[model samples]
Target: MLPVMAETLSQLVADSFEIAWDYLEATGELGNPDIAANHLLDTIEAMIRCGERRRLLLSNNAITAYQRFRAEQPLSLAS
Candidate 1:
């Protein structure tokens, strides 16, 4: 759970992604190829990308930039 100050989707998703990554990285969960965690990462990225687009914050292919570094570049694999 997040603090009251972290009510926004951006804040919650960003913090959850970072915290989960920290735990996984410190415990080698990332190396184990856990699909759940990977999906969580993907979900966070999706939320950020969607939020940005909805808020008209997208520009210069800045939306989901890291997703390009992942799979074969999902142009529109759902928001």
Candidate 2:
């Protein structure tokens, strides 16, 4: 079980709505895409990269899920 932010990964899905709400408030900007969280996608990506640097594999399931996520809505720089 991946311990993330004081909770197991399973809790994250349950907490996503609250996370999105908090994220919306902090960013001071709102839109359909939750662009702030979109920006934080790098935090997720960086975690994966650092794992690789340590010779760790981000489990196949995680990689596949993330790929599906990114493929669903690929991110690009605004400018």
Maximum-lDDT candidate:
1
Model 2, clash count? 0
lDDT of 2 by residue, 1-79 (tens): 9866555443443244344435445654323345434544443445445543221222322333433455566346221
TM-score of each: 0.37, 0.26
Against the reference, the lDDT scores of all candidates come to 0.47, 0.40
Query: Model 2, residue 21: displacement in angstroms?
Result: 6.1
lDDT for each residue of candidate 1 in 24-55, tens digit (9 for 90 to 100) = 45644333345434565565666566664222
Indicate the TM-score of model 2: 0.26
lDDT, candidate 1, equals 0.47
